[model samples]
Structure formats: C-alpha cells, structure tokens
Target chain A: MKFSFPKKVMAAALCVAAFAGSAQAAEKVYRLKMAETWQSNFPIFGDTPRNMAAMAEKMSNGRLKITIDSANKHKAAFGVFDMVRSGQYDMGHSASYYWKGKVPNTLYFTTMPFGMTAPEQYAWFYHGGGQELMDKVYNKFNLMSFPGGNTGNQMGGWFQKEINSLEDLKGLKMRIPGFAGEVLAELGAKPTNIAPGELYTALERRTIDALEWVGPSLDLRMGFHQIAPYYYTGWHEPGTELQFLVNKRTWDRLPEDLQEILRVAMRTAAYDMYIQSYHASAENLEKMLTEYPNVQVKDFPADVIKAMQDANSKLLAEKAAADPLAKEILDSQAEYMKKARHWTDVSDKAYLNNFNAE
Target chain B: MKFSFPKKVMAAALCVAAFAGSAQAAEKVYRLKMAETWQSNFPIFGDTPRNMAAMAEKMSNGRLKITIDSANKHKAAFGVFDMVRSGQYDMGHSASYYWKGKVPNTLYFTTMPFGMTAPEQYAWFYHGGGQELMDKVYNKFNLMSFPGGNTGNQMGGWFQKEINSLEDLKGLKMRIPGFAGEVLAELGAKPTNIAPGELYTALERRTIDALEWVGPSLDLRMGFHQIAPYYYTGWHEPGTELQFLVNKRTWDRLPEDLQEILRVAMRTAAYDMYIQSYHASAENLEKMLTEYPNVQVKDFPADVIKAMQDANSKLLAEKAAADPLAKEILDSQAEYMKKARHWTDVSDKAYLNNFNAE
Candidate 1:
C-alpha cells in the first residue's frame, strides 16, 4: 500500500517538474511580433532583428519566437516608437532619434554631431549611466530601448560640390534628418526630409543636393555613388547607433529564462551587426573606389567643420536651457565624453595617427 | 476500451511531448571548473568570468554552473592553456599570447604592435576569418578559444625618462612581456618579465627602469603612476584581446540549448567586458590626472615610434617566413586591417580629429 501511494505521488511530481522551466515550456510557444523602420531585404538595418530572433528561438529551443514586419509590410517607417509603445507590435527596430518630435529628450540617445564615437557611446550606455537616462525617458511611455547596432561613423553626406566654407553650407539643399539636420538648418543649409525610397532620385534630380543615409554599409546599395561625386567623411551622426524597442508589458509576460534568452540574443545580435556593418562598409568602400573611380572620399574642410561644430554647440545650449531633463542628459553626455574622448585620443587615436606620422 | 486505459495513454503521450528537446535536457546541471590568469580580487579580468558564469547560470535557469579557480588556488597564471587542455579545468580566462612559446602561431591571435585597433580587430575576428584561423591554431590542442575581453589600446609603458629618440630605447631595462617585448628587444631594449606583485617594487628600486602593464584601468591600481611619471601612449599591443579557452570535450558534452546558452553568454560577457574596461579606463584616467597632476602622458617621439614600428615589422616578417600558418594568419590580418583601417580612418579617426582641429 505504501509503495502504490508513493509511486502515484512521484508520477504526479515528475509531471509538474518536467513542465516547470525547461523542455516542457516548449509546449507553449511565446511568439512576439516586431516592427522595423527599414524596408524588407534592407541590408544591415533589417538583418539585425532577423538575426536576433533566430538566436533567441534556437537558444530557447523554440520556446520564444519573434516575427518581424519591415516598413514594406507595416507601411510606417517612422512609427516604430508608437507601434511598440502602444503594443501594436511587441518590439521595434529603429533609431532612437526618430521620435524626437514627440519626446524631445529622445534625440540624445543616438549619436550627436560631435558626441563620443561608437565604443565610447557604448561604454557610456553600459557603465556611464546612459542606460539609466534612457530608462528615464522611455519608462513613461511603457517602453524599453537597447542599442540595436552601430554604423561606426556615418559619412557627413554625399555632395554635388565640395563644402569648403560656411557659404558652401548656406541654403545647401541637403536631405539630412534629426538633430544633425537641425544643426545644418541653424548653419543656413536647407535640410529636408525625403523618403528613403525617393533618396536616389531626389539626389539625382537635385531635389536634394546631398543626403546622409548611413555609412558605406547601406549607402552603396542606394546608388548614391553613381550620382553624387563628392562623398564626404562624417561629422554629423558620427557612430550612429540604431535601437531595439520593446514594450514593457511584452517583456514582463515572459518566464525568467525566456526573458534572459531574449536579452542575451539581442545583445549578441547587436554586437554582431556592428561587426557585420564594419565588414560590409569596408568591402563596399573598396568596391566603390575601383568601380566608380570618380567618387571621391573627402573630409569637410577645417572652416566648414568648425562652422557646423559651432552651430551644433549653440543648438545644444539652447536645448539644454529649454528643459531640465534635457539639460541633465546633455550635461551627463558632455562630462562622459570629455573623459572618454581623452582615452580614445591616447589609445586608438594616437595609434592611428602613428601611420600618418610615418 | 476502459476510460482509465485511454487516460493513461493520453498522459503518457503528453509526457513524451513535454520532454522532447529543450526542457528535459536542462533538468540536469552542467558544472564546469574554470582556471583564470588573474588573482581572486583582480578587477576587470577576474570580473569577466564571473559575469559570464552569472549570465550563463541565470539564462539556463541554473542549468549551467561555472566555478572559477583563481591563481591563488590554481597557482598557475600562465598554465591556463594546459589546465583547460588537459581537462584539469574545463575552461580558462587568459591571453592567447601566453601560449606562444609552446605554439608560436598563438601569438597573432592576441594583439600586435601597431596592429589594428579594438573595433578593427573585432571586425577581423567575427567577419574576416579570424575565428577560423584561431580554430586552426587551437584545435590541435583540444581547446576552443573566443575573444574574452579587450583591454582597449594598451599604454606603451611608464618610463623614468622620456623616450625622445631611437637611442633612448637602446639597452633600456624594461619589464615588458609577450610579442611586444620581443619587438622592443629587437630595438635593443632589454625586455624582462617580472612577477605582478613585485612590479611596483621593481620599478621603484630601479630594478626595472620601465614596465608596460595595462592601461589606466588596471595600471592605476598597480600603483605604477607613483613610481614612473612619464606615461607614454600605446603602440605595442594596440588592442590587447584576452582569450576564453574551453576544453573541446566539455563543450561537446552539453545539450544544444545549454550550448547555445553558454555561447551567447560568453559572447555577451566578452562585449560587456570591453565596455567595462573602456569605462574603467576613462574614470581611472580622470582620477589619475587629478591625484597625480605631475604625471605626463606622452607619445613616444616620431623617431622612437618609427624604430619600434620597424622592429615590429622585421619580427613579423621573420615569423611569417618561419611557418606557413603564421604567414597565412599574418597576411589575412594585414589585408583585413588594410580595409578596416581605411574605414576607421574615414570614420572615427576623422571625427576625433575634427574636435582637435577645432
């Protein structure tokens, strides 16, 4: 009698433990839908979410599934913030600054015209309280944001002509966007917003004289090299970081294990995407040189860069003065950059310069 | 058929379905022992493994447990390769160059003097066949290696006197280890290895005139600043990437889910440590300047840097001539760095210079 009762109890216990955290949880697949800003088959930007989802599913052994809808599918390229925050999609892949009009503080998370570079910005986010500030901004909207991937330093933009002085910038019809666009506008450049689909045509037709998309990784595919002869090195959006947005409710609904899986997958995918972008950009830049020999890679002259920098600083000062939270965020970034930039100068910067001095 | 019979059949079927792939395997814990190169309280280096283990355990829901044995316990700072290979320790946290004496090709996997920077080297590793090359070197040893963490760019060294010319390096008594030490030796510097605990005493008592430790992050704690005031910028070990060694047998035994969990955990931890090092370096560098105001951060003069570069190139050429695999690795790195450095120059380097120009 004792054996019979114990066997029954043991059988019931085994069933419960089996279904608890591990393989048994696979019986109920937790599927999440994500919206991304880029169109389907978009190079580095679109690949990030897909790579993340695949990792999460494989690591979780099919316990977690993420399905993505690109801009083509969703028909809302800049609406990722609203979609994820409102739970229209469980997550989103977009740049943080896209929602700057709605959340003015959101502008600072992505790269600034003269802010810290990629590694420095990442260091600031993980260790120097950038994540805390980001949380402060997104928590109100019931959203969580993480660094999606870095484009290294973005190109300044492609120009039909060289930007030699401040006069070269005045009324210059460039299709830059976000804070960089604002800075350009302050410097008297006519910065306009155009759909990415229309960027190549617009640039060719002189609807926009130049446009800053991304670096060589995504830029080569846009056919900008064929049309724009002067490809300028970056000043605006240096080390631009795309973002991953998750609805807090969606994140909370997962088991602890799945949550960790999703988090780690996203983190690895983000880092992977950065490396991928670097690789693609390197390869593409080489191709652009050999194939389109006339596409010159030039730096913005000293006077032009200085003018943009001055305009950037002035606009930042105005923004800092307008809002207390903005001031806090800006001050923190400035202080962090001051320290990090010094390290960069001593380390990589000096080492890179060694080649030139040779 | 009896109703009870059908119920039993249904329950058995459900059990089989629940325990199929993921959860059933996670029910058993995989405990691994890791040997680390640093001591128990070592800051950045020791923290990498702990961070990695914590992430692995949490993400696997306590399924994968990694316990580390520090140098105090293992008493083998340089014996990690053997420990992990012999299965005495299931894994190791150490630099790959430490094993170069036994396996000459292991030298290229870590860092090189005047080599690519952190981001560039990372791009090389993930995208440009680095992992494959690393596998070729480590596979025969029954070990698997991954980039554990990056120390960013290393400081050249702390000197009692300025390295103003090539003549200054002649017969200089320096306690610098690994490949960089060899390069210095080629330039007529007497490169020696000293115990970590005795480094400060060695530098202070004039036993060693100069010593290259890590950058500000780890060096500040070692009290190198007080002993030597002339802190030079990095050229040697431009991006010193520490390594994670896993015994192949141990890796092969884990279930698919646990394997994925461990891999992702290691990858994330590696990236996290790089950011942590960057943050620490920035903070410590700031503190060092405030506390030791007299300390001068100098770059080795153009002539001195040129000599070192020449020495490095000569040694690399010799290594390449000695072994076909070494030749392959060197050529791959050179080619990748050529492309990646161009991107870096046009991106971060250009942007960083803009600030200086201003």
Candidate 2:
C-alpha cells in the first residue's frame, strides 16, 4: 500500500529542496475512494463528503481525485469503520460512537451527556490535546480519525408528555441510542432503538413515547413537532461531532502536496459542515416555530436533570475504572472543558444574557 | 492592472470542460505578494497570513506562492486597502473595519456592537447573504474581501472603578475607539484614544480611567490584568472578524485551481485563528486567575447595559438613514441575528446553563 516514497521522506525532501523534486509528481493524478454513512443526497451530512472531495480536487489542480459512495451505493451504513480499516474504502465519514462496540474508547470522541458545546469541543480537539488523544486510540487500528462535523447542541428529544420530575422518567418508552440511552436506562426509562422511517409512526401510534433524533437542522423535515408537543432542550449529546476516518495505507500513498491538500480539504469541510449545521438549525427552527406554533420547547426540571447527570457520571466512572485509555481521554476532556467553559461563561454567556435581556 | 485571463470565464470554462482543459496551467508558479496589518511575528494576528501562505503553497505544490510583508516591512498599518486596490500588493491581510474612513461601508463587515458571536457571524458570512453584500462594496474598488480570522467575543474594557449605574459612565474617561466610542460619547463619557504601547502606562498613571484591548487571548500579554481591577464583559465587537483583501487583477490572472486553493487556504486559516484564539483565551484566562487573584470580571449593571444598547440602536438608525447601502447591510445583520439568537438561546445557552449548573 505504500507509495514509492514515504510521506515523511517526501516532506523532508520538499523542505530541503522546496518543490524541485515534486514537479514530476504534479503531472500524475492520484485518485482515491471514500465511503460515507449517509444516503446519497442526504442534506447536511451528505454534503460534507462531496464538499471535501470537490475542494481536494480543485486545490490539487487535478492531481488528486476523490469519489464517494454513500450508504445506498455501499450498502453499509454502520460498516464504515470495518471497511476503512480493511482498505475496502480509503476514507469514511461517520460517528466515532458507532464503533464503541468494537473499540470502547471510540465513545468519548463524539459528544457526552452534559459535556462541552460546539466551540468548547472544537477548542478541546484542536488545542486541548483531543486530537492527540484521538490519534492514540485510532493509530493502533492503522486509521486516523478527525472531527468530521458538528451538529451543534442536539435537542434532547421530542416528548409527548412534559417531564416534570424524576418520577416522569420512570417507565417512559423513549427511542434514544448509544451512550446517552445507556445513561437513561439507569434512571428506570426504557430506551429503545427505532428505525428512522418508523420513528414518526412509532411516536404517533405511541410505539415510543419519545425519540431523540437531531436538532432542528434534521428534525424540521421529520415532522416530529406535529405529534410531539414538547421539545426538550438537550442534555445528552450536547455537541455531537461526526468523525472522518482515513486508512493509513491510503494516506501513505499520497504525495506530500496532495496529502496537504487532502488534509486541509477535510479540515475545511469539517468546519464548514458545522457552520452549515448551525445555519440550517437557525433557519429550520424559525420555520418550525412559525409553522407549528404549538410546538413547545421545554427544559427538564432541576431534579430530572440532576438524576440524568448522576447516571451519566456513574457510567463514565465505571468506564474510566475498566480502561486506562478511557480514563485518560475523559480526564483530558473534563480538565480542558472546566477552563474552556469558564471562559465561555464570562465571554459568550455573559454577553448573550446581557443582549437578550435588553 | 487587469489580468490577461479573467476568473469568471475560466471558472465557466472549467465547469463545462471539467478538469480537462487546465492541466498545463498547473506547472507555472504564480507568486503573489501580501501586506499584513500586524508587525512581524505578532502572535495570532501574524500567524494567520503565514499559515494561509503555507497551506496555499503546500496544497498547490508551490504553484501558488504567497509572500507576506508585515507592517514592519511595509510601514503602513492601515494602508492595506489602498496597497491592494492599487496593485501594490496582490493581497493584504487586515481588518475590513480599518478601511471605514476610505470606504464607509467597510465598517459593517468586521463586527457590530450587540451583534452575533463567532459561529453565528461565520454562518452569516458563508451561508447568509454576507459575501454577496461584501462583493457589492468591494467590487467597484477592484478588490475582494474574505474573512481573515476571528478574535471571538472581545471583553468590554477594564475599569478603575466599578460601573454601577448610568452616572458611572458619564464623565468617565476611557480609551475606546470607533463606533463604540461614539456610543459612549452619547452617554457623556469621554472616549479618547491612546497608542497601544502607551496604554498600560496611561491606565496606570491615571491618563485614562478605563480601556479595552482584546479579550484574554491578546490582553494577557499586554499586562492589562495587573493594573485594572474590574474587567467588564463585552458589549462591543462581539465577533471581531478580520479581513483578507485580494486584488481582483491578481485573482483573475491565476488559473482556476490555484484561485480555489488560495480561497480555501484563506478560509481555513481564518477559522483556525478563531480556534487558536479560543484556546489561547482559555489558557490565558486560567493563567491570569491563578497569577492574579484580585482581577474581578464583571458585567455592566443592567441599567447601564440598557443605556448602552439604546445608544447603539440610535446610532445604527442614524447610519441607516444617512446611506441606503449602510441601511441595507445593517438591516441584513439585524435580521440574521434575530433568528440566530433565538436558536442560540434554546440550544447552546440552555445546554451551557444546565451543564454549568450541575
């Protein structure tokens, strides 16, 4: 899988001689393939891979080409990790948490219940050693994982009933998934998984009392507001960042310049997706409110929030005790978040409160 | 000053022919010169242009070479617009607001008092109608402006005495500049200006009662925490976005792929600076609190905040009345912020409040 020259050697030679040795490499076009976890033409999520591929192609001046296969074409929505690691695909765009079954440490890279917000999480990734920690987890599998995109603070879920206290969560049938669902299960709630296509009928027919999809960015088109009167503010998955995975074998084949182009393209597309999600959320939320004026946005009572937080803490503590790597990532995120959150409080929170009050 | 080949025609041709016709253009190196507003080695501000140049060069395999001249070399901290517009430099890295004196509409692009935060502002710039409005302003001058970097939410200022009421702002002498100063002047505060190098001494020697630099990201280095006891939260320049200006002539001369490389490079670099600033602010704020425990971060009292907000609205109204274009730009921002803020409240703000409370 390795190219004629290694990346490190190419980078070093390029540094010493500048672009003198790489002129020949520029004439040859290198093409790579990617597999995404979303269906073809799937709005914000689907746009990320296409955006990344287009930017890489344009930036490399036709030297690098990338083609993408979505879930429909690949027939593997949840098989992204396996496919990427086995070299069935050069890269993948999916969530890290999806691989928690195979690699438990993958759970921490996405979002956590009552964890950092979008900006805070990004600061953690780029500056607070999150990237290095991610490398430690993924490097063993010969894969590199990067922050693919963010859905901002996801809404908790659409609830048919208002959650007044801890008693309300008892025996509640909710379609929640992943780590957050595990946290809720500890609180006497029945957290089930329902197919996306069945979610609306399930909620309407009371197959599930509530379901946590995404925020308004994806939720508006789902028509959840029509059946669920109360849209609870988020606690679980505050900043749900998706993941980008690159197989080491494929990466080792890229020329230094094309490698740089691919890296920057992925990075830019990741950030762009976050902004796109934010814009979509804002636009969609406004549209939802105007169209469905009865859709009430609610916050869980203090006691309910407290119960959920306690459950989350217990789960994290158990995970931390079981694995040293899990302990390290959690500790890093907690420490970074404490300081970053303080700054957020004084800067954005304070300003927002003042401006909103005015 | 016109380039031989125009970008629009090239872009159209590339779209019709795909990458079929542009292979030969990739071999020729197109070097561009850029002038920045900061001095050589000025921390975050200086890092942006260098980062952009490095990415553009590496991504384009050195076909797009951008060399930067800082204020130390160019001797014009505020002359970026003129230099780029006249083709003295192919590009310039500076704040768009700095060109307010020369181009009155330039002030609206950087940031506004009581406006959107970094992510919101970025969403507006990229997804909202901001880029089109910017083109309307810059096209006639033969320049293109892009978001260079963001400084996040700036701190209000440091005060010698606490601002408890509207009376406190009256007759208070402060070294604040631009539109914020005009708002302060409306409240009978003496808005003065001082050179950056002399600011610390001026505040200490009672030459000024208060002053604001940037937030903790850049302010800690300036030693503002040592002298000022009361550090106020921001009301002005919530998301202070810097600008990168490109001479249209230079942009048109480049092959389409190189142009795309340069554009994406500038964009990624700008977003990186914002994350860099966020990380630095958190790290520096931690440092400041640990090293100097006496520094008290305060929000302006509700009454004072109301007065300032009122003054801001009044000024914006006057500006809108004076010029139709100013009215157009200001209205666009106001409308964007209104919907965006509502989403921010229910999403990030609510989640942050819940997490911080726990």
Q: Best TM-score goes to which candidate?
A: 1
Which CAPRI level is candidate 2? acceptable
| Residue-level error in angstroms, candidate 1, position A171 | 1.6
* Candidate 2: C-alpha lDDT: 0.90
Give the Cα RMSD of candidate 1. 2.3
Which pairs clash inside model 1?
A22-B23, A23-B23
Evaluated with lDDT, which candidate comes out highest? 2
How many angstroms is residue A93 displaced in model 2 relative to the true structure, after the best TM-score fit? Answer: 0.8
| Model 1 chain A, TM-score vs. native | 0.94
Tens digit per residue, CA lDDT, model 2, B266-297: 99999999999999999999999889999999
lDDT of 2 at A276: 97
Q: Per-residue lDDT of A1-358 in model 1, one digit per residue for the tens?
A: 5674566557667866866744545446899999999989988888999999988988877778999999889999999999999999999999899899999999999889888888899999998899999999999999999999888888888999888788888899999877888888988899899978899999999988889988888888888999999999888887778899999999999988789888888888888887898899888898888889998888888887888889999999999999999999999999999999989988888888876687
Which regions of candidate 1 are displaced past 4 Å? A1-27, B1-23
lDDT of every model, 2 decimals: 0.88, 0.90
